[model samples]
Target: MKFSKRTKLNIILLWVFTALPMSIFLYYYYPSQPIDWSIFMLMVLLAIATTAIPIYIGNVTIFFSQWVTVAAFLAYGAGVEMILVQLSILPMIFRVLFLQDLPYRLIFSSWMFIMVSFLSASAAHIAGYQIGSMDTIQILLGATIFMFVSLLSNHVILYSRERILGQKEKFFSRDALWDYAAGLVTLPFAVALYVLQLTMGWLAFPLLGIPFLLITYVMRMYNTAERANIALAKASAFGHELADRLSVEQIVNMFLEHLKNLLPADNIYIIDNLKGNYVVMRALEDGHEMRIDVPSDTIKNSFIHYYFTYSEKQCYVKSSEWVHEAPDFLKNDMNSLLIVPVHRNKKTEGLIILTARKKYAFEKFQLDIVHLLATYFAVSLEKAKYVNAAVEKSETCALTGLHNYRFLNKTLEIEQNRLNSNPHLILSALMLDIDHFKQINDRYGHHAGNIVLKDFAKLIQKNVPEDAVVARYGGEEFVIILPQYTKEEATKIGEKVRQTVEIHPFLVDSDLTKNRLDEIIYITVSIGVSSAPEDTDETMSLLRNADRALYIGAKQAGRNKVAEYLK
Candidate 1:
């Protein structure tokens, strides 16, 4: 209903171009005979009826009104034919106005129909078409020229419009071919209808109208079934892709990517509820991923909360249906919306929101497809969570929550291979031991020793660089693997660890004292450092040298100290 300044200008220009020439032509070429009002009204009705139901081929909609127009032209003249053609476009314009956001299409379609009718009629008149004279060869020749010009002019206008709009589309496509073929096939029917009208009078309408309506109905059914089949196939393939993903992030990305292919959307949002707190996991605007932080109050005020709380899937064909309840985050010039709650075992886990800039942008079938995709996402997320937990249990130390010996060995091999590939790179290893660890267990209890070990792992993790790999080697011993560290750097890190551990307090239960109060005791660690190519090239040998230095260099000389491999 509201048009921008540019659209108003285009509509004015289009109307002038269409109406001005048409008025001048009609004034100059007025029919000499008096018009038959009843017959003309009947022809108008037939044309309007045909325009109401169109057969779709790909992106093109083929209307059967061409035959009715041809019959009208033959019975009357080009002037009347042009008028009827313009009037017939009203149904399609109304359809678009109510169902889409493309108001410019109203004037554009009018302009296209006016030009096509005028130009094609002029061609037929030039080819010796005359009202009230029905000769077989001349009629055929004139109708053929008219149909050919009509099809060609339509494509020319369409291609020009597409090019002006910056679209890369060829003038002739399979849809165009279908249009031409349909026109040719209906030419004879037009002639037959005109001939039948001369004999059957008004009864000739149903003779042709009934069969055309039937064909349109059948084609509509077929197109619906075909679309449903294609959607199912695409959904199945998308489910397979989701199943192959191994992480929640991967699944979210894949869902967004495929959902865009399934429908036209201007924005997408993935909102997850983690322990009763709503968080925006992912967002995409205009097909590009974006980071957005929405306040909790805004989400609570929006329709997302309603959907999540009720576990309902909703589709809004117009903004008015939801604008009253929408928060600031949902008021982004969007008109249509589809929100589906992600459910797992009858509990809502998250919500998926898709929005478009046009009315009726999302259909019912698309909503169904999104529901199926949500199910697929929930299943894949559960599978990935369990798979990651299983993998972590295999590679992690249960007591200290650090990498176990198995992971340590695997990491060493990987670091050694990386060092071998780059001559300039260096790998460092640190072997650390808690000095007199058994004495604490004997004095207090083994439970106290376990607490010390856990606390020591936390301290080591806090001191090391994030990229460094720290693992519980065995007992009170631990290993650290540092990539790209020299021997001197590793020794400096080892000294830092030794100093921190010697001054740190370890909390333990006073079992031998038989007191309710827990006691804090001091502990010390001996550390040894070794580097690749400086100590030995092999990974295990580097570890062995660091271990030898920990016992012989540090443990033998002092209780708590840093030592480097002698070799």
Candidate 2:
């Protein structure tokens, strides 16, 4: 495929910035100049430095991260000093080209300040070299002009940068090359204009400094782009590797740890949704170490309220604006924060906030990545919930609504899993039988018997605790898995079930005649209750005992009563 016009233009611009100016700077400085070796070295240094101007102008003002900016500036400055000492203003070339022949104001300010600095040094060493009055006035006038131009340049540079450069952005090779050319081509011209102004009188033109500024801008673009690429590649590789190796909880923690490496924030917090309450899993303040805490219920409630109110967009509260935005909870303490709403299947799940010591510490891209990771976490959590639900379902019976035979085994599994935390707790299993249910089906049609079973089941359901698990064992029999209850407690539940079923008339009238369909009837049920084994090894014996008690209750004299199984 053919490249687009923009891509072609960028390619052309890169070659020009990278190759053309370096060739020209080389032609002037080689072979014959005094201290040619030193001059060429300085030229090389300046050429390298010129390419960093774009990044400096774009990123420095907003992030206020002076360390890297200063590093790049120094590198550029030293390179210019070695490669093209006299002609260090390489931004002028691009200022004439890309900027529509209009000069960037930074060029004028930067040059003017240097000129003033030189003049100040000269004036300090003047030793009262009294010039004529006219010359003195001319010198003062020139100084004033330079200072005013420099101040204007400063303002223009700031405004231009803020409007032109976006937040948390990365640059590419094509853009970087443009910056390199701008800085390289303009360095000579910028120096000439400054030196010429000092040598030649009122005839000098300051606008000539703009082309050099443009070159500076281009150089910065290159350096910034290069750094961004390196950072992204490293983050991607590390994140992928870490994600693969770590467990789910560790991955969550690593994600929290990695946010600081990519973005700037004063504080980072991870609040997990634990039963409708926010549990602060981790907190980062400044660049210091992180702290983990299980906060109070009140604190969790505060977080829930905060999230419910502002879980859509992001909440950024400045120190000055804190009183207005979060007067109650923030209470004038928060500086600035980014609040992102985490979602799953269009439902709000939780909220995340990354705060900055300064105002507006977050960018859309940073927030996007952060939220993207959050989405992954949301999906993982959703999967975990489904798994837990499935596990719970497997432990109980689906039909007859009572647990199946496997339930006794699962009860032991849970008890083992509980780690003996609560020894005071007791569990019981109650097996119930519809007395002579099969014989009734033989005598009174099975349809009538089915009604009896369902009616008796309803009575048992009403009498048992909400926590009780009641399910049909098979035809004519059922079971109840009762937790935190002893034999006496199980007896109470069983006895109540027996009495309710024996008295509650299932049918209003009997069908002693030939198959009367409108017959109302009553039924009796027998329940056998057994306690859980105190020792883990005795679980099987406990279940067998419970089953035997059920048979005993069936054989007992009373038609509707409860029986306890003793070891």
Candidate 3:
């Protein structure tokens, strides 16, 4: 998706607003005194926090903001002894939130660019302010030292993160965190240089602490970045393992398993449907055990309503969100659950309901992982549904979506092949045809004839016995094979089908393509039924006899009627 021109313009405007104020504040908003060392650390922490806020804004998750705030606040106490200025954490923030898992040198280069940009703007602003009438060189040089340390510390942290993940890049090529702790390394050297310059009576001695502070900031940022990457790697690895085992059950169990990980006292289950009856599939009360299927829709729907209603927020499965008959296993065992519907192709297919055994047993990250797993579950379920539909299609008629001739043939063979040996097994078949079907096609049109055929199919379907096989044989002709049926039973069913089609009207178009829906027309059919005899051998012979009886019924009754072949 392309961002609109207006949206692109607005984002640029917002970036300028944050960057300009930060630059101006760093340049001119200091106290009028020579130095306040205590507040230096505080101001550095504040600067880093301001920088990190944007990074957090980009990541935009509750957990992301929380962890970033904690890490950036901790980075303030780094390298302040060596560098007179406080350590800045802006670069680490960018690496963690924007350019993730990159080389240390690349991270440092990006940080160097950011720091130089900020320092240059701040230096210019400070010169514009005319503070104490000092030359511009004094402020620029001081900002330059801070900029170097900030860049170094940013590199160290980025390297540390890469090292924890067992990855080596150009900057993170070293195995040890100490090698990349440039912020800490530069701190001692900068302090020593500043001391040497001060003892030798140089004018720049007092500002060398900025370099020391820069180095320590780099050291701390590297440490924090490395630790976060380690934790993130572990979290990701665990997720992969869970997903590898993910089924309809494992996917749901994973969410319920993490209630203790979230807060505590959380349980979860899936009911089969969201809007219909309750079909519970999996439940977790004691440990991470799971079955093959999820719960019923009745229980699942309660969670679905909750999920759709509270999509904006992470939800817990509460008693209020569920129905009265939640589940015998889940009822009274837990109080609340967070419902996450497993959706595929934009519609909910299953539900992931996590219950809170205690208050807020699940945190935000738990919900995130569950949502991810839902996608995988949906894919698996879709495969299962497709396999079932394919199996059904193999046996069904392509035109009418009913049992095809192949299945009917197989059914007749099975019934007769056994009946010949048993001598007691009875079988019957009805050969039926639409009366004057060709005349109707000529009178109305082939299109009307098609409607008549489809309706005729439905008519036979409604009248046939549950065990009977009804199939289209050819144009306007059909066959009904009934196993374990005597001649009398077959004749009764033939009559039922004969009457159903005789009364049921079908829409047929007129000669001029007029509306068929308005016109009503009736069609009749003749049926010939024949039962298996103890001496009967060939199935085709029985079919021939029934077909002959059908011709006789049509000629004698002169209307819709059924004729049975006598034994």
Candidate 4:
């Protein structure tokens, strides 16, 4: 949990206010009786052990150390009990602040524990708890007051902190109920320890400590298994969703979105390896998407190169361990990192780098989840690649490598719909035919004619606007669709293509029987242009008008000329 600067300052002020009173109270009520060093040490150790194995319920952790604190309070006085409880809070602080990478939790948790301890101890003292007395009624009364005050104060502090931080957490929840129930359940154990200690002496500690430790261990294992099951269920659902996506861009976007939900990260980078050079394909930083273009040599000197060369997954808990090899973009405010290589058929396809602003931010379970997602991502990407290839094959001309007639028809239909929706939009079409093409085959063989056709396709493609769709219309004929061009503009482009083709030399071998390489041949083309809503409102009429102009205005007027359909 990160907090705003104002929230952090408010929490620090709250801690100061609570700690000051607690210090003064402890000073005034310092234990007057001589302390038993052995018993004190035993209680401290037991408190530490119990605090370490807490039961997690949602965002709240329930520690059994309260039993130890109550027992210490009954045997020694409030002064000793407060010290013991405060010392026991160290392990929890370490776990929440460092292990969990929650910086704001350090101040909030410390103040919360102090407030709970002081209020509960005050309640027990007010209830007439006489230290070293074995009266069962006083014992039960003091213990009940202690536990009740502790539970209530714990929630009160939690609710207060949340309110102060301007968070919308409910005051009452199922987890809160669990906290109260857990407190009730642990009360008897504290009573038993206090009563049995007078009878069994040192034997009482083991009798209670062993079973407490055992139960804590069992609950910890159950929590781990439950979390694993939940994570696996999410991963299975994510994999199914990825399978439904049909493009690489969609898969990458979905992968990053799902990953952000499943894990905590400050920055996520998807680096693609194309022909042995790493390129940053997509990057998500602080909830925004961007692209980072770094020099190849700069990337080579970073940890991305290390992962490619080694082909092993890596998780660094602290930036200091790997800072020297980090790229420039990742050098600031990034502490933890998990890098997983996306593999397809035993070869590394790309790399996924997840980074955080705090140390030890990623756990082992999160690493496992990332590996599973990477596998799913690779498989989906491969499927989309093959599907795209198949679609490209169906729409491309095999000989000329240009859009085939089928694709041309589909494009014209799509453009016609667009023109119908927007009357102001312009669309133009060009029909082109090779002049005396049969003579090329008769004089220079069919193979030479095929070479000339391929060259002619390349020439038209090069001479047209990039957005223009050039297609092989049929044998010795080609079509071009200019989406935003008028009749005048289309005629200009048609003239350009006709002039280039007339002057260009087609290189082909005149004979296949002899190995003579270079034979120069020249060809000319006749072109006609038509615009939608000017010559006709429909797609078929647009092509028809262009063809009519090609034959009448260009072919009949003499080949190697450009003409537009006259309305």
Number of clashing residue pairs in every model?
0, 50, 51, 0
Instruction: Compute the lDDT of residue 151 as modeled in candidate 3.
Output: 47
On a 0 to 100 scale, what is the lDDT of residue 12 in model 4?
79
Top model by lDDT, which number? 4
* Model 2 stretches with alpha carbons more than 4 Å out: 1-331, 346-351, 354-365, 385-396, 400-408, 416-425, 439-458, 465-471, 507-519, 534-537, 553-559
The order by descending lDDT is 4, 1, 3, 2
**Candidate 1 lDDT over residue span 204-317, tens digit each:** 878877786677678777876777678879998999989999987898889999988777788888898878778888988888888888777778777778888999998999
All models: lDDT? Answer: 0.82, 0.52, 0.54, 0.84
Q: How far is candidate 3 from the true structure (C-alpha RMSD, Å)?
A: 20.0
* Candidate 1 segments exceeding 4 Å error: 1-67, 70-85, 94-109, 122-133, 174-203, 302-304, 405-446, 465-469, 477-495, 510-520, 526-567
On a 0 to 1 TM-score scale, where does candidate 2 land against the true structure? 0.45
- Of the candidates shown, which would achieve the greatest TM-score relative to the real structure? 1
- Determine which window of 10 residues in candidate 2 has minimal summed lDDT: 62-71
Candidate 4 residue pairs in backbone clash? none
Cα-based RMSD of candidate 2: 17.8
- Model 3 segments more than 4 A misplaced: 1-269, 272-329, 333-341, 346-348, 352-377, 387-403, 410-427, 465-468, 500-507, 512-522, 532-545, 548-561
Q: What are the per-residue Cα lDDT tens digits for candidate 2 across 1-567?
A: 234556456545544564345434433432122233443343334443443343433233211111111211122321222224224334433222312112323233343333333332234224332211125444344333323332344334444444554433333333434443433443344334334444553233323324444644655566556655655565666555554532456556666677777666656776666566555566676655565555446554454456644566565545554344432333243466676767767856566667765444554555656666666666655665676567657755554444555665666568544435665667787877887777677666766676676666677788899988776677887777787787898889888888887778776222344656566556677777787654222445555666678777554656576878855
99: Cα error in model 3, Å: 52
Can you write out model 4's per-residue Cα lDDT over 358-415, one digit (the tens) per residue? 6677777878889899999999999999998998899999999999988998998899
The TM-score that candidate 1 achieves is 0.79
Q: Write the per-residue lDDT of candidate 3 for residues 176-262, one digit (tens) a residue.
A: 333224333433443344334334433223344344345445644564465445445545655555555525355445545543353
If ranked by TM-score, best first, what sequence of candidates would result? Answer: 1, 4, 2, 3
